[model samples]
Target: MPALITEAHDSTRLALSSHNPGAIEDFGLIGHKVAALADLAQNYTNSAIDSSELNRLITEHFPWWNDSTLRYFPWMRWPFKVMKDPSTYLKMLRHKVGIVIPAGDGNARETAHLITTLRNVHKCKLPIDIAYVGDGDMSPSIRAFLSRLGTNVNFIDLTQVFDNTLIQLKGYSSKPFAILASRYPRTILLDSDAVFFANPDDIFSMYQSLKETGLLFFHDRTVENGNTPVRQEWVGAQLKLAGRLPSAHLANNSLFFRHHIDEEADAALVAVDKSKPDTYMAMVFACWMNTKHVRETVTYQRLFGDKDTYWLAAELTGVPYAFEPWSSARLAQEPLIDKGFPLVAPVENNLARGPAAQVLEGASKPVSQASPTIAAEVLSDEKEAKSIKLLATDTSSSYDKNQTTSRVEAPHSTNELNFPRSSHNREFHDSPKPITPNRRCTTHMVHPHPDGSEPLWANGGLWLDKRDRGLGLANWTHWYVGSRNDEALKTFCETSLPTDSPNSKSWLTSEDGEQWHNEVMNTQPRWYSNDWGMDAEGCPQFEEWRWQSLNQGFRDRLERMIEEVRKVEAAWVLELG
Candidate 1:
């Protein structure tokens, strides 16, 4: 049982209460001590004492924390209750942590590209923390190189924060720990290979509010029909094994224990407010799922790395979380005009076209990885400069030739590249004439928001397809768009989980019934590659920009991102010298 003690000075009746024996004893004297500090503060405010005198008063009362924080003092640390080796706690109090990126040698080049993009292209003012596993993955020379890539980039070694006994950053493990090691009260974790159409800060607007739920997660591609009984059976058993009740959130989940649902939570970007209690507890579960034993034994085997665990942990802890309404979409470079601008109707795109971004920078490199304004290849194409821009840009606004280079245009449709449509380009103009969109071509998993608000970013770097990584493939332009919810699963959840059956409350389930569980376990299942939706004719969808929809912005941004990456690549080569 816990004892309760009250603060003498605070008017709202604050209490010092805890079930932990150490907490009770540690905080028992805190209220009175704080009350005395309040009097001392009042005396100083009233000019009753000098700064030295106030210092003396504090020194007289609390000697242990006098030099630490109460005078200059650590909050939620010190005096009564001491924390266990809280390495980053004080760092958190001092620094404003913004975007947290977990980098290693494989993704070092991509991470450099990302940092450069944030500073130069996105103009992200938020401080960035680049966390790596250890010195083995990111050497001192590499760290020095990255440190010079952009401003306000801080490096954190994950080993110092987490026990080496519990984690090993091979495979799909480092993503979760990066968030766990963040010094920010609110953490925004992004993979190193990620690129943005909008500034990094603005993506938060896509969420309803971080207040109601301290976390926001995006769903994975809903590209396939739900026929995953093997995985669903495991999910149901995991929920039961953990003693989790079917909370309203999971009870009506479209994926959990259901056969016809697609994957959940993309995890390209994870936004969490660690200051909230619910988020704190939920984070514990998330980290646990990513730990060695659990992740190796089941999590990685069943789910796609750390992607689905964010939502799974949140639900298991019963902490509310929000998801973006739009389902995911895949982007690919438009085929050349000579190569065929528009495909024959009803043809599927290439299977190599889909898979989110990832950092292959396994070895950190020199700082020159800073993306400059333009690429050498683009600069070399000066003869075709005006011609390329004629296709990519509408008006020949005299631009900074030094910072900008001519783009190489794929011979596209006549109506494509018709530009100067103002930033607000929702209104349509068909004078040049638009191609009839193949209805089947508007596939799901190819839509991301980035209109007036610039609400889009992607994990894969400037590759048309990630498979040809490091081969310098062009950015993907033709995107598949459209998404749908599982209406059938919603109906089934209502029918199968009956609340009136027994002693149930707050939800439909009156018992830990296995009826729905059995059905999910017995259904036939199928596996899906990320590029499963490319079956619809994916031929050069954005060859010509549509007046009503401006995928044109993404195409333009892609050019800029590629240019920056080239600059960084040159810098890295120079470092080898």
Candidate 2:
């Protein structure tokens, strides 16, 4: 129990001794209420996920698909020269090549383009796996469109299998992958937005490395934008409401590689039933394992340089990889060259010449290429030079005659040059349009009093009658010290006053006046009254006096309490580790 409870109970008894028996009983009731609330918090801290039910739930919801069309691909042919003691699992036969596609609603065009590009890369070879794990109803048109492509594609509709489970767990959509990891260990998880610019041999390499670790985590650059707090608080609220607290914190949407399934994974699935299932169960698994295990077994690796660097390393090193936003420059220069543009095309030329030049110039920008402005001028000159050459060929006979030759200058106009007038006009006219800044209102309105004498209902205002004011102050004092009988204070303040009672000013000198005065002084003391006086104690000297010594003692007690809670929290962390 908290020390605050004991201190509050003793203080309330001493302060309310002169009150009626009913009032004393009310104070005791308040103490009981506070203790009950504390007990609820403790129970929540100790709750955890049930493992047996979780495993059953996962197996029950597994999706069904056409087995004939679905081809299980093996990673046997991958270059394994650098690996030490390569697993025999990688050398098995079947489809050696596979493409992983993450599917969602209304992304058929992008997915189609991705498939088209992948088909182009593989040159009509290798099987493709289209993994769809979202909840929106998709049209048959999109499904048929993808199937029409020559590549073998498998659509894993997560919604069909886990319909009931997803409905039960509102936020945790990542459970399917957790279950999938244990069932189909070789499958790759891809993001819907990912585009394949080059061959994906590096991706397979990362998967091999991740198989050694129990789990793999990706780093998201946007994680710093308060996503951690938002997710943690979201999970924390669910835990608090379900009488389970202190779950793990992890980001969703990053790639994860799961090597083995254990008790902690099952526990996480149990928790998923109580709330919206998260898209990434690896995070929840990490949190649950951390709670129950002794050593950290989970591995978190970033996929890209800075953001993409780690991902790149993991891919190159043949570990399980995660995806993040990457710059266009990361793509291989070969594919860009094959399409037309040289390996090193001038950046300026590509920008000035537009998409046509971009396609012709290839993936890399050349070192000797002119700037956009210079390239535009050079291109214009080249066009004019070509025109001159054509005109010379047509008029060569006329120039060779001995007769007096007349020189004719051709008409030159901006329109005739075919310069982009609309683009130029837009650049000039649109440049001065001021960016509309977002407006924010920071003012807060205060509620005013009807009588309007310093807003009597305002803080420190004389809104209540004298007796009511005293009761109000006393009630606040009781609660601050940790008492639970707030009803008694409310009753005392609502009681009527005597008809012939003198004005509030006269009560300052009466017998009860002296007592009330001392109460007020004790409740709201001056800064100069404390041991430190004005120099150290800012205001309310009595509180400052109590705060100095009491705060240190409170710290010591809280430290001990926290240490005990840490042991409970650590149980989950240890399990995952």
Candidate 3:
């Protein structure tokens, strides 16, 4: 092997020194220009050589190429002229692989988790190298953990390099900056949160296919809308701002393959370092490179969507890409396999359990039997209409009087009776009563066996229909439970608290029950108002009534709206907090 000619650490100095008249430069005064010219000549020579002689030489010495010359670039070609032989350059490229991972103070737990998981679970046939760049002191715990993985890993502190510039520009904590800075050609930059979901053989295979194409970028399924040709202009603007590439190229960075190592590529990398060392700049740089001669690829997985701001940066960059379907419909069509590996398992225990679960549990309950008395009384027409009128006339009074009392007397209340405390209570106090016009009743029957056991229902069991009243009560309870202010607290106890379930009455307590209720109420409503916004005229009522309802009727309509807002808030909090 020809001895490797390592380039200077300062690439700009190397470029400048190559043209300096005073000191001698090893690669000659022309620097990269000379290298480019030499490559052109070698390519020309290889192309012109006689086929018969060339075939004989290649067969005897380079049997790998006997099958196809297209597989190997001609050594006498334009690009190969700088190198002594094409095989030598190709060997150098093949042996070196770039590995990247993000690290920092907040991300340490997740980052460590990812590294450990990758080391233990992911089995790669190739002896791939690993590189980690992040912020903060290299924790001995993480360093030692990674060392045990049986791979050579390099750690670079991003904060030391940027001098807080990155902190000011993008406000990203150090870990992400280091990862973006250390990216090299022909390397795979994996995010700390990204677990190896499958054997990456095909992923690597795709990378190899882009060898001639320059850089390869993975397409996220969710962010593909930004990858459309029209979005390329926006991507180009970012690249131009970074001074890496002129307008016309775009790139994204969920997953990417870097092919060619050139000055422009180097410039792209530096641009990423200087201009907000986040995923977007990296994406823009990639797009700028692709506009020249880079190749890009994307998977069909929806998991790759650019739903986040970092993802937005990538979509702006125009590059060759593909997207894999990870959408609900697509996932349903081709379900995941449950292999021994954690990646394909049905339950991913590796992910951190977020606060959402706690919030959900505190706010919700599984389907259970509705109180028999309320079911019967509420179902009756004369009693039901009277309750509706009461609600319409004075919702606050009806809610406050009934919410706690109904829960306490759940077993005795009947479908024909209005809840005892409200104004409508007298109408159904003792009557079997006619069914309400629009109101529906649902019955839930519990059976007891003989042998002194409870008796089962002989005829068709209790029928239960949708309950708007119950939902309204639940919403009110939630609002009060989540009370950050006096009004919300009042609303929860008086308007939203469920009247049918005695267990739900705990929402009125001053203990952990109240805390749980408040968090659930607070989280969803604030998230919705900030993300979706309520109209000004009804904003106060919207805010108040939003948390008071827990009925299927209200939940079915608002669940998606709530989730969307929550997701946006969650994304911001995860990165910012």
Candidate 4:
């Protein structure tokens, strides 16, 4: 096995130096070089890969590729570099409101637009000390715009703190590093397109308890847009190794964090290096911070889209925050100035009881009635068969006597789920018993058993370990919980089977639910997984791929079913808070 890798402590170094051992310099020379190469790759990939240039280069001789491989380029030094000297940054009276605008011509139009709007139209009450992080001197227009704000706005040029290689990266790079390493104890990083609707000075005081360990980030309202495809597999593998949860939501526009004296700050920067398509930097940082225990608290609020940002941050950090009133939007996309801005204020912080609680917002949900106490069975009555079976287990003393087992009914919609009354009755059992071959059955007409047995189950259960064990149902406990879908497959597999267990059954069921047997299941080995393997703890290394794949299948059926059900039950929301 390869040596156990760990995060870096140096601010200048990459998160995982082992990936580019030759690039390791006196400080972070190698990491910087790799970042430069990544910048180069990003440019090439964006330009050539996205257009005719790729075909042109591929069909003809492209000297760029032949000139030097990415790994060995004579690295260029960053121009207008600003060293991270906390003393210089510390000179500020209070927090620094940092904004990064990446444009080709070094135009600060976005910066100018945001600040000018905040100063002129909104007339923000908060005394804004802006840290403009970008390249080149501000254009005359930007300078003139700042001059209007005068002493009210102390503009600091932080274009130097970021590496020169990152100038072309076209994403959030070194922003976290700049924020975390800044002289200010706290920082609120905003995108260039942000327009403040109100004074956000109180955000820092909202959750004083979490102000130390947890970084505050606004969750993007739309998480379904998906994440950048690059480094997803690699980051997923790292999170699994670290035993951290995949961020439920992606944070893009707004982030709040305090400078800390730990490896987590540096680690966030490294995560940037390790991953590509920097759109989801907040998520990547959340995962890294959670793994490193960098932040002890993670507080999310409905500051972004309805509750999108709040839930997404909650998903990644496993932390929770109450709904607040201070709401801002990217005017670039949402021209909602006519409708009045969303509100944001300090609300009570509520620790998520568990994963389910995080996702059960606004959507009225009853108690999860699914319990492990009543074992499930399959009974095929020639005339009638209620999806839940009553077959006897092998351990049962009397196989002839099929007990009338109490079973939970699948809700027509997620909101209608009737949970068990007892608090001790966990919504879904973390460790479910493995399904015996005889018990592994489905009811859906579309999904038949791989052995050609009758399909009896309907509630979208996960494939346990993907091992033969008759390819039996492993953990059906999570059929009701929406939050469990992504992590359920691996969690169930890790609990029910041995780490080294190889799938013995060639005839397995499909995750997509189109077919039950090997015809479909054999073809789809969890979505992105290339092979089946496990660590000592029984957790699959590439569980993200499988989880994503399996959940997508469930969502395909569940989402449509949900929409139809919601259309019918739309009036029921009047009862909710």
Candidate 5:
């Protein structure tokens, strides 16, 4: 049995009131000295402290740390406590890690797109070792693409580690599990649809914050205005019942972490159950981690998709995060060259080719592989010039022709044109363009869906048919009037369009109106493809100037269509009749 010893510290000496030979006899005055160490054995975590610091700090107190008996002692695990080779701790922290899940059929195409773009278009500068977790069958395209991308990618079949029980519980949805399984101490989990405008290395700047908190996430908004946060109490109740962390709304899918969620991981399956409504797997488990309180965390704003899941994660995590109103530009359609107007041509129609095809096709090849003749093909079309504006506009005003030309000059090469440099600067210029009458008439200028689908035109608004009827109206009103109000035309821009920002003016100028609709809207999902409630009669006629200026002629034609639709709806009866 060990004897109890009283420890006392003085200016030069440490004295024990009572003695315990086993605890202190080995080091004459080192009992207090050993206690001052950073406790790597019990509290091993990622940090700059290496074996040198460990040796320096320990040797100064107990110079016999390397003694065969002292070194092998279970209690004094030393530098190996944190890392087997403590010298490599800092180097491990710098190794880029990508925690990716290429699961589900929908993600197959997205997986190909991500790897292809990251390697070719975005040109990821970081040396990321992508650790993919999913069934091997789920990502054949991704695998093929990865082979072309060279040796930095890693593929892990879920069956290799997880037993049938965990795998059957829809484990593919558990982002935390996938993250924990990665070999890297620090990992970044990005969604498949995530498009990168810049190098992913920029994300490493948050490494300190990630290391400090052990976890970090981003905040995001919806594609249109349809997303509204669910009741906080409801989200809390679901999370608490399922054992998760309570969040404000949703946590962005783009997660960065220095640790993994291995403890009680099996219990986390309850969060991913398909039966539970609004129970997002990532949000549920992240919230659960918060309850454990072993890790520090922070969150910031970055744009993303899947609002319900992402928003719930943000709300439950309750980490300090930033929110940016406009952080990215989205994909849009290019008008058909022969038509001399902006139009979303059908994907199957050979004659309906647009510059967008060139952007995607050329994006897969390196800058040197592209032909100058192919680049000229993009610039030669008059409509391509307008499409380039959609890619780079800041505000609604007409884009500078010179600026648009410069941006589209080398369409075959991703490096030459930054693509989204915002051709229309957000500066509100003075223009006496008529508002309501012109806006109403130009409804014909609204481009048809790229795949020959008709838009959901109903009740004074264009609906994308996203089921949330208000979303269609809100989106159209925002584009037409430049305000977020559901009834923006009736409220914010009631009398006339405001010239300032939404807070001050609450309305959009003709230029401000054009930039978001033509450029930004194209980037969102389904807008350019869906056929929402179209008759066999086909889409509206094309007129470029009407869409460009919102002139009086376009408004007159659109008003007639609005009246025609109202008359048909009023005369028609329900299916019972």
Candidate 6:
């Protein structure tokens, strides 16, 4: 219960960090945190502490650690120099959560729609901070219009808060800025186009994962060759150079150093607690990755924009973070109302409907378990090719062409997967030889509530197709998903915070933690980094998949949300009219 502002106040004052000058003159803000850290460091002055203990404590208090005590993973290698911790500082620090969304000229319409949906449909009461680059991106007229439109909304200008001298506010980089700039201790960061079936206010309460780690990032779809050489080498080098220790998250990440897994992080919706020293440091590093020099040099070119930086920073900082156990999924071009959607989507676990049943043809699927990560259990029996080619065709052409004139045999599921669907999909899939489905057809990334009860949200807007807006409102319900190997994740995934201490860091470096870390890393399924996390373009296409369909109740809820957002947009002022 320390009232601490973990932001780099000392660094910003030095005029060395990218934050503005004299960011927080009030030393009172970090008073308790400083006192607590001092007591811990002074009390633990035993000369014989091991490298593991040293690294753990450094992450515990940061800046308070003595650089001379380097047993392993030298904190000095990635030092916390004068970084401006998002120019804004909170006077009182407590366990509170709020929302941060990046908005401006590019997505003003969607921003309006999102705000309306959050306030009206889900009825989320969380305060929202709408962060834009500057007045240029957030025109005064647009700001006025949004203020008049939204409730509990605050605006933050990145240029004004962080020192824009080094980094330009490109859309990709704005995520970290908005997140760090939030006044709340915990931040729910979202892209304007995000559509949620559940109330965001329920986020801090619904999942055990969020309570345990304060930082939960969702995954990108599982695609082959996701680990590329350039990204792999860079991250690998950084990890090695820093002499980083192995943690369970690294083994479970999309880019597991060696290209064994996928290669991305979906930023559409991210949850983080900046009050934690480890997480605060991770955000600073993530922000630096988006800065002009770093981003232009290797971040964007090697990785997929700013998507992967969040986890990578956490990994490098040696902080505890979580990516939901479930694999990423997406909506079909149409709703379950048609054969095209059900035929190609992961086999829905619900009873099939009229036209949708015509295609499945009564090959009823088994009822899938209520498990959160069903990607592996529901995957096709086919040993999909490691690589598939992507066509440059537009969304309009792909869905239309796949729907008409083509009737496909469903890919067999690995388990008793039928909840509703008569069978699995033929499009964007493998197993039915000669006909290659578009594995790269995944566009709108999806994440479900860990319990599989309802969709938490999906990125890329509510439009049926972002590429072809004319198709009308999208009712994306089904998902093709994957998850990390369960056996490997059991050790670190959603582990309860150690009861003895306020945070998990205390016992993490103790004898039991050290033993557990060693046992888990050695026993995990795959233990090689032969493949880099990714190449310039991570995957040509991906293959293995599972299907999870929301129930009719969710579908009904989705329709209501879509209709509500549309109404909000209908009243929106595009040009200050």
TM-score of each: 0.60, 0.29, 0.31, 0.31, 0.38, 0.60
lDDT, candidate 6, 1-577, per-residue tens: 1112223223222322232222121111222233233233332222222334434444443332223432111122222231233122222333577888899887886787687778777888988889998888889877766665557888888776666775776878888877777767788999988877778887866778777776888876544343454555566555653346545765444334434334657788889876565565567567767777667776777788888888777766566788776556644422222222211222234222223212222232111111213422332212211000011112333344333223232223433121233344322222112212222122566787877655678887776555554444464445544434354345443462254641133354466554444333322212112342211111122222334444666666765566555444323311232
Q: Which scores greater on TM-score, model 2 or model 3?
A: 3
Give model 1's TM-score versus the native structure. Answer: 0.60
Give the alpha carbon lDDT tens digit for every residue of 490-570 in model 3: 444355445564123344343644443443233111211232222111122112222121234323322322222223222
- The alpha-carbon RMSD values of the candidates against the true structure, listed in the order shown, are 14.6, 30.3, 25.5, 24.1, 20.6, 17.0
Q: lDDT ranking from best to worst?
A: 6, 1, 5, 3, 2, 4
Stretches of model 2 off by over 4 angstroms after superposition: 1-100, 122-126, 132-136, 163-184, 206-211, 226-577
lDDT, candidates in the order shown: 0.49, 0.26, 0.27, 0.25, 0.28, 0.52
- Number of clashing pairs per prediction, in order: 40, 54, 68, 32, 37, 19
What is the C-alpha lDDT profile of model 1 across 393-499, one tens digit per residue?
A: 21113222222233334334434433222333221111112344331222223335534232376666544334433223243435433223334344445666665
Instruction: Please identify model 4 stretches exceeding 4 Å from their true place.
Output: 1-109, 120-137, 159-171, 177-183, 207-212, 221-232, 240-577
lDDT of 2 by residue, 2-57 (tens): 35544534453453343233321121222222222222222222113122222222
Off by over 4 Å in 1: 1-75, 78-97, 223-227, 241-257, 337-447, 450-455, 470-473, 484-549
lDDT of 4 by residue, 1-577 (tens): 1111111112212433334433111112222222322233333321112323322332132121211212111111112332244334323422433232222223233344445444444444444444444434444444444444323655544444333342321233323333322333334455443333233445455444234323443212111112212223333333444345444322111111100000011111011111121112233232222221122221111111111222232333333332211111101000111111111111112111212122212232111121112211111122112111111112122111111122122223312222232224221111321211111111111111122122211211121222321222222212211212123233333444334421212211123111222111121111112211311122211111111112233323332222222211211111110
Angstrom error of the Cα, residue 314, model 1: value is 1.0
Off by over 4 Å in 5: 1-84, 87-91, 94-96, 99-101, 104-106, 125-136, 139-145, 167-174, 206-230, 236-284, 287-577
